[model samples]
Target chain A: MRLARVIGTVVATRKEESLIGFKLLVIEEMDPREERPTNNRLVAVDTLGAGEGDVVLWVQGGAARVISEEHRKAPLDVAIVGIIDAVDIADE
Target chain B: MRLARVIGTVVATRKEESLIGFKLLVIEEMDPREERPTNNRLVAVDTLGAGEGDVVLWVQGGAARVISEEHRKAPLDVAIVGIIDAVDIADE
Candidate 1:
């Protein structure tokens, strides 16, 4: 898992039926030392009760499907599993 | 694929052997309208030559595994496939 900030949300009115209840967020990749935002971003499903501006953890692929028992049958790539209150990196 | 901003880099002293030569970046999910920074973040592999502060697009799961031929054998869930020079959403 890597550190990132939620930049936006995605609303897919027409999508797989399984994704009806899940929320999708847009995320961007960042550098830790400088904390500068980069160009890499993705759409992830939110399982945790994370709102905009709340730092959270996201998982993908098989791991992502395992986040929620419901997702086991959903066709999802990214999923938010936890909200991060604080992060303590070992060092700069 | 989703939009994200790169926040930082990741250094894994020990990891899957197939991920040796790839560059990993930390990313945060974002919103397109308000563009506020949310809490959902993740680590993604960069295939494109994207740097800090550049918005990019990321793919995951089966799609991520297909980004690079090498990744077919690697254990990666997230990957940066392209740099987002611009994005035009339909409307607010």
Candidate 2:
């Protein structure tokens, strides 16, 4: 998983049926140490009740479908799995 | 999903039971245009018969579980979903 900051939310009225109750958030990748925003941005399903400005841990691909029990068959490509508490990288 | 190159394979004798028949490969993230490797490396389950030196499209998180019918309950965090055939980025 990687660290990302939730920047905004996506409001889609007509989407896949399985994704009905999920909250979609726009996230920007962040540098591990400095927490600076990277150029990559993606819309991710928020499974952990994360909101804008929260640092989250996201998972991408098919695994995103299994994060929530209700959306087991959702056609989702990205999902926020956890809200990051802290990160400590040991110097090499 | 993101593009990555299969660099090496991982072998473990004792691991999660659900991952027994799956092949684990070490993948290096690549730039979309240049295909140059970035500073990330991950061990991902190969579901689409990808081999070393192949460029693949990989997905991470819980969504990876539903890629194959057999390993749906496996404790996998990353998986290669497709062997990339081509990537064409339209000029702005």
True-contact fraction per candidate equals 0.16, 0.12
Where's the lowest-lDDT run of ten residues in candidate 1 chain A? A83-92
TM-score, chain B, model 2, is 0.92
lDDT tens digits, residue span B1-92, model 1:
77778766656534444567887777766676556556666677887877766677887776777765787665467788888877777863
Could you tell me every candidate's TM-score relative to the true structure? 0.52, 0.56
Best by TM-score: 2
Candidate with top lDDT is 2
Model 1, A1-92: lDDT tens per residue? Answer: 55457889888899989889888889875544346566878888875556777665565667567444577788976766545454433331
lDDT of 1 at A30: 52
TM-score of the second chain for every model: 0.89, 0.92
Cα displacement (angstroms), candidate 1, residue B20, comes to: 0.2
The list of candidate 2 runs beyond 4 A from truth reads: A1-37, A41-76, A79-92
